[model samples]
Target: MKKMLLIFSFIIFVFNLLTAQEKEKAQPTPANKVLSKYTKEFAVSLLKGVDDSMYPKIFKAKMSMETIRKGRNPIKFVYEVYSKGSTKSLMEIVFPARDKGKKILLLDNNLWMYVPDVSRPIRLSRNQSFMGSTFSNEDVSDSTWEDDYDPEITDEKGDKILLTLKAKRRDVAYKQIDMWVNKETKVPIEGVYYGLSDKPIKKIYFFNVKEIAGLLRPLDMRMADLLEEGAYTDVKLLELKELESVPDYKFDITQLGR
Candidate 1:
């Protein structure tokens, strides 16, 4: 009986030793491997630049939105977009003559749409679809990605840096995003937004970089819906001006269509 007890104790000890070895193998081996020198702070600063390279802080932009889907004619709309800081924005549709004068306001993560004849402003969520396009309301809204995501530099290619952004909170539109940025220009090259299950939900590419508002920025953005093949949206910036500031009342829900 004593020998059997001794044998059982030996087996338990060996099992625990093997378990510990497995756990050690699972942990990152930074000491043994040459790690990337880029720190979190550096990653954050680059991301902030990438955000500004897309749009200016206080500006009014004229853009066109076109949505293409399989077995359907492409739908297009033109708009004037007003933005202030990182939390407030207003988009007014100006084309498709019949749909003109419609406005959408984004304050923080909340959205409100005002139609020409509607009595009240319709409340919307930033996570929902924006005007039937593949881009979400948050995508159209003025938001600081650096605040919502914690960025990590994963790779550096010839002229681009690849970053893996993890959502800082659960309520965000994407759980993770793999973004590539042009190192010299600070303009985002492309990104793939992933869901909570790590499934790629959308892919976005930036093009047509030019000097706008004293900064080099991408004038055209394309968002492809990963779930729906051949379904995508293109938002092209027609006009942009960086202002000192935008009027406060322009973002008021009650002042949507005014």
Candidate 2:
């Protein structure tokens, strides 16, 4: 009888343990544990603010670029933009000396190729390569960040989050891009760009993070060309200052011809 009682007690204990395990499994994890609070909806809202914060109303920027070609030393091109984004106002950069001295007025989409002998505004397409580099007018056109990219959280793996971005319009360069965002920093660690195919046409790695306007922004970005061997582009953001006020007219393409 005592033996029977012991067996019955052991069975009951096992049954209780199994029930406890089932109950533990049935409990749902907190949403924060399973998914980042920044869902697709939240990312969309955050992106709106992020885009606005990147642009200042009136600002000056200096870009020094090194163009690489096969079997040749890279050529350096230095330029600056004095933009209100209000009018079609731009300044051609004079390099080799004077950090901020020589400035030429560029009033139209036609950028005058200032040669030592000839002086005339040459009509150029936005798609033309700038100084043997992949940078074109489409790359340099003063654009609103809000109009360029939309970040949506699509998936998550462990602590890394995947974000899918759809270009606002076909007039923009990239059709689609996938970003791998850090769960903690809310910043994109890496990005892949897609063209007409499922394969990524370009892979980008961002580093050198610095605080800008209370948010961390990538200071250096390296983009690798998938098609061309040993071809790549590196963009280093120098300074980004927010503008106090900018006229709405700054966004006009007609201003490009001004």
Best by lDDT: 1
Q: lDDT of candidate 1? A: 0.86
lDDT of 2 by residue, 151-180 (tens): 667678887777677677655566667777
- Count of clashing pairs, candidate 2: 4
Q: Which runs of model 2 end up more than 4 angstroms from their true locations?
A: 1-40, 49-58, 83-91, 96-128, 157-159, 183-185, 197-199, 245-258
Give per-residue CA lDDT, model 1, range 1-258, as digits (tens).
999999999999999999999977554312222126987788889999998888888999999999999999999999999899888999999998988998988887677889988999988876789888999887887788986898888888898998888889887888888888998888999998887666688999999999988889988999999999999999999999889988899998877757
> TM-score for every candidate vs. truth?
0.84, 0.60
Task: Give model 1's TM-score versus the native structure.
Answer: 0.84
Off by over 4 Å in 1: 1-35
Best by TM-score: 1
Question: How many Å off is the CA of 111 in candidate 1?
Answer: 1.4
